[model samples]
Target: MKASIASLTALLVTSITALRPVFRPRAAAAGPFLTQVDNETWVIGNELWNVTQGRTYGVKLYYKDHDCVGDAVGHYVSYNGAASNLNWTSASIVTEGTIDGSSYIDVKFTATEGDMHWIILSGLAGAYQYFVNHNLPTLGEFRTLWRLDNTTFPNGKTDVRDEALPPLSEYISTLKVQDETWLKPDGSGYITKYDFSSWIRTQTYYGVYGENFGSWYINAGKDYYNGNHLKQELMVHRESATGDAVQLNMIHGTHFQVSATDVFPDGKMWGPWLWYLNDGSKEDAELRAKHEFASWPYAWFEDEAYQTRGSVKGQLVLSDGRPATNAAVFLGDSSPNKTALDQGSDYYYTGYADEQGNFEFKDVRVGTYGLQAWSNGSKIADVTTSFLQNNVKVEKDHLTDLASLEWQVSAKTKLFQVGDFDRYSYGFQYGGSPYEHGVVDKCPADLTFTVGSSRTEDWCMGQSKLGNWTIAFDVPKAAAQCSSSKKNATLLVSLAGYSTGVSSNVYANDVLLGNLTSGGGIGTNYTATLLNDPSLYRSGTAAGEWRYFEFPFDAAVLRPGAANEVRFQVTRNSTWHGFMWDSIVLEW
Candidate 1:
């Protein structure tokens, strides 16, 4: 086992904070959405809906990661009220279904049209360590738009407006980051306006930065169209010192407004959606209160101009021609934008194949795009004409249907392979040292799959370790041993040729089971357990004592059933000779 692979990762997010106080009703980290299979594995999901302007939407509620797999569950709440009345009503996530080969859940809301409803999505899964580089976008869409189109100014300036507003009206094309937060307050060029004579002229502006947030305004709110002038720079401050050096053009958009009136809930005044997704943290609150994370509140990505020309539909299949449900599919245009295209592009659009392997891309601009599929981080093989060989064309006025796309990818690691999180989601822990060593076709093991390309022998010996290596299993709830009334369970460990000066201890439900420095026959490389194994037919001079040690654990440290967590570990503080583990057994 590589020491690099044994490090622990922060597995869940806890809270949320929106742009303002009113955006407060938006849910934040509502406790970690996770379920542990064992101490070794678990899954997480989150809500990520991209509502279009027509309210017709497509969404990827949870982004997949290396280890997590499952579909996101959503609910339509407030049964008693009308559509408009229930738009902001709060609700809980009712259920979730697993997607075949994908890591996260997906939903395309076009089929559920006419329902203008509010939603609360579960969260996504991953080992999120650095907030600064984590792909989860805090402020995806930072832009400006004119609320009302084709308006005349009191000065008789017809269409005397900013050309910059057009880009903001569309989704993702003109998206900008709040990286360089503060605006040049030196009356810098604010040129996207036209003087009354229909003659375009440049204006000047200045801005200020707030804690975790900031903004820029046209200098003096210049006289034009009765203060309806849409010359502003929308910005969003990042939670960390710096966001990704390259930002993603990924958030499915709903509002691409360069002006205030364009926001939904038309009757409102002043600010855009002033929401705060309460993630139960002051720092998170302060961060969210400072900037707009895209068109969050009006997240519906739509406009009459955005139609078939910007949309696409397709299907997916496995190598065997069956529906490849839940495979992660990505579309991107190296020319328009780059994304995780692995194709060297930075802009991209993401979604997953549904139960039938069907998929769609909403709110796309007219351009050429390439498609890619992935399952648990490994790229799936495309058996058909190479999607990478030719870029698919997404023209205006029509939906590009590629018929059916095929993907081929599968898990390779064996279930019994030590530290394998994908299979036995067990409580496996390691520290101090990492190594692998064991007799082939000798020791009894539980893993059913083969290790690597060839199997030299049948049983797992362990990884070969030189410096130091450790392995511990947190007995899962299902195979718990201390459940009966007698409650006393003894864990027997088999080892061969281990380093000297080894110490042992066990933990149940996180409670320590008192340390035990001595076991059955120490000093010799072999413990009592190893000597008793009938399978150990030493072919050559035996390396170590090849012994076994038994540690009796009392009921006080172990939980009967509810808190069924059994942890055991062994460590060699000083370097001498490394070791090999044959098997472990629990006797009541």
Candidate 2:
């Protein structure tokens, strides 16, 4: 019996090995011969090559020793083929080799006939290590080195080289570590404005860095009219003199004056622009960039044209007569009757209130503008109210002191609320880790959340097309109030992200309330959820902006002194149709 069992096991093992595809290893290269196409993508023999179906092709990836550290044992090749429904398949084997005194990772895989075929080489430094150069603006951790087409290559081999980058000193002359306070927003204890401006000008006069330095420019000239020209520069450095990897970005532009009668004409401002420096992750670097961008037209500018700019100051009070502390206030162009909530293409200025609700916009361009303010629900209780004051005038070298702007809440009595109003869905389940895809697939099929008993994890961050989500809650005095008088119920929904062209049908106790259509599509949640590396789609907090809406329904639909269910169902049948809620409040 033992002999027979061993024979059967041997037969099964032989059958599985026979089914596996075999790949031949390529010989070591004599020298580096790969041609560069772009920063990330590269080619082998020629700029273009035709791929033959069912033919095995060899791939070699060369990298510097310091850039990545690991043997090529774990390195493998993968391809996304259109013929295979654009599915990603891994190569059977990987091997280590050397070329011209440099280390190279090698793999072999069969090609398929497809309209779009992307060959991906990865696993250079093992899991969670330095897979690709972080300085470049490449997508995700893995690099897509080649794209297969109907072109032929010599010996059916694909090879690419990663050249050593020059030091940061080569780009900026007299490089010195900036004071830590210069990176702060308050500018307290920082160097003098004149000294900082002089340092910035010296860096700008230096010619643009090379492609190997990961430098790019943004032309703000086309966006803002009225003869306003602004040029921005962004660069990623591998390491500084202190051996710390730092990402540096700077924006410097000339400012012009706008008449008070004009609507601020978007983008007209004055200042010596600021620069951001960080040694954090890519997401942290982006956040720093956003802060520097918003803090434009620095009040300390010594420019002659900027000396005559005025300031706007005011206080914000909520409907409950409480100071709206830490609220975000903005002065935007009033030409098209647009407010801060509109998020128009016109340029806008942003500021925040202090603990006493006193907010001020410094160095405001002499012009007429619209003032808007909204609380992020940090200091005060969450309320679905916004303050807007139009026809605000700011004169040259004058302080425009406006009256206290009061925010009026829509609903009076709030029965219950789900999630916080911080303008993000990070409080709910599957919200913090947005890098994963197929989040909806991993969620419960029928999510019937009980208000008091269910925790935040019970509520998914986004609604899926698979089915409707039900919220169950008990309102004790609902029946008694209905007997005396008919009170309307208001549903306030604050969305952190959403898909456009999709509508959600809301119901109370099986009765129709209203069909809510999403405003704009600012996120790729639907498409990103389908990919293996969903982290590639993540843009941190820049993924989407918060949008607020109110839905009024008949109070009779909600059961009194009993279990009440609010159902939300998407009208569209698509994986991409969804909404990420920041908060949902039921008010009477």
Candidate 3:
């Protein structure tokens, strides 16, 4: 009984010692066991069992973060290639427990099966790494890479191919095969699988040996190529590919001769044959010289060439060469000998005088045109200004001048400005001083008005009654002393009157204190208004600037050169607000 008790105690002690936690290996604490399988890298992070495919092939990753406290637990692959959730399915994992009562972790994996060539299990987002593993095949599974966003190859429609799929078998072997190891029947050479970075370097690398290279296999769709290689072509851009530098094996025996400035350049496009070719030697070039091309004969004066007309410029002037303002101009051709177009039936356009008296025609065809000018909408005269012969017979390569002729417009009478006035007094215009008296202060030369302000004062000389009347400035002349009967003479007046209203019933045009009241307002105390209308006047609340008023008298109104009487009337409401007038000038 003593021996049995000792043995049982020892057995229990041994079991308790084995249950104690063991320290994890230091080497594994830094990282997981790393190895390459089929040119891919596999790593075990905090989440165990991670796999990464290299750049050549699409990546595959694996990760796990599960607690195994009571017993060992991990995922496993069954014989049928399906994975088992429990870790005990495989005994291949090497494991250890933590000393500080933490959970144990382990990772184990094996080769994959089936057509799922690319798979991933990752904890980090957007992180990618490459490796050279011995597990993956040199020639990967053949599949469609990418497709174009445009239509089919040009050549019209009749040359469409039946098969749109790529030759995957041929592509798989060719692409994976290294440049150093060309295709050999024995297949013993080292097959190289490079990523997009290495491929781009290989393409853009133009070295001293004159070896030109480019991406032979693009993501472009198969629809771009017809049965004939003549349909689609590749261009060498950036670095020009000379004829001697062409890579025979770049496109499976296909070669291109192109410069850095080819049509496609670095961008891929599908177009006609000649647009893609850049053969250095004329032996393969198709040249079409301009001199060798056919010519279409036509005559034109290139300068005045009006093709589809909207607006065009034509010049005109009076006979004395002064700028003819307000002259009406017409454009069209009329000659009895010329039968190309009917004189009256041809297209025509009319132009009105601008400030410079020049006219322009719109929507007229390219041809010679006649011009006519009139005054008062009646026929003045028809002078032969140079006819506009637009796009007429001329050398095709040289430009021609069309505006080489001059127009001489003539008129019987010219108008001019005589002595003008803002306001004047007739017989017995009273209640004002000598400034209001009807007489020339100064004729033909210069005249100035002397302004005197009186606040709520009585009427002055030449006036009947007065409230707040300012000294009036007047000028007297007959309308006959002014310009021609065909034109209008103008007198401009600008002044500010007191804003004193004599009676509520008196309109601005009605007589107030024996004289018609023009304008007097209380708003803003200062404003400019036109004095042309007899019904309107400008009055102010206080002293303000001179505001202009112009009155245009036509031939009938002016009595055809009769001198006119003008007067400046000043009256105001409230009797206190007023201003003075000064220095008035006249111009033609």
lDDT scores of the candidates, listed in order: 0.29, 0.41, 0.24
Index of the highest-TM-score prediction = 2
lDDT of candidate 2 vs native? 0.41
In order of appearance, the predictions have TM-scores of 0.25, 0.49, 0.16
Better of 1 and 3 by lDDT: 1
Candidate 1 lDDT over residue span 1-588, tens digit each: 112112111323323223110001123333223322222222222332111111111111222111000111111211111122112211122222332222222221111111221222334221111001112122212222111111110011112222112122222213321222221233332111111111111222111122222122221111111111111111121112212111111111211111112111221111122222222233443444343233222223222322224667888766656665555566653332322211211224556767777888765646677675543111221211112313777787678888876555322211122221111111222210111111222222223322233232332343222222222233345545424455566554444334333344444455554432333434432233211211111111122223335556664554433424344344432222223443444445
Q: How does candidate 2 fare on TM-score?
A: 0.49
Runs in model 1 lying further than 4 Å from the true structure: 1-309, 334-346, 377-389, 408-588
Kindly list the per-residue Cα lDDT of model 3 for residues 155-260, writing each as its tens digit.
1000111111121232344533332112333453221111001111012111111111111122111111111111112111111111111111111101111111
Ranking by TM-score: 2, 1, 3
Candidate 2, which segments miss by more than 4 Å at Cα?
A: 1-307, 335-346, 432-445, 501-503, 517-545
Of 2 and 3, which scores higher on lDDT? 2
Summing lDDT over every window of 10 consecutive residues in candidate 3, give the lowest-scoring window: 149-158
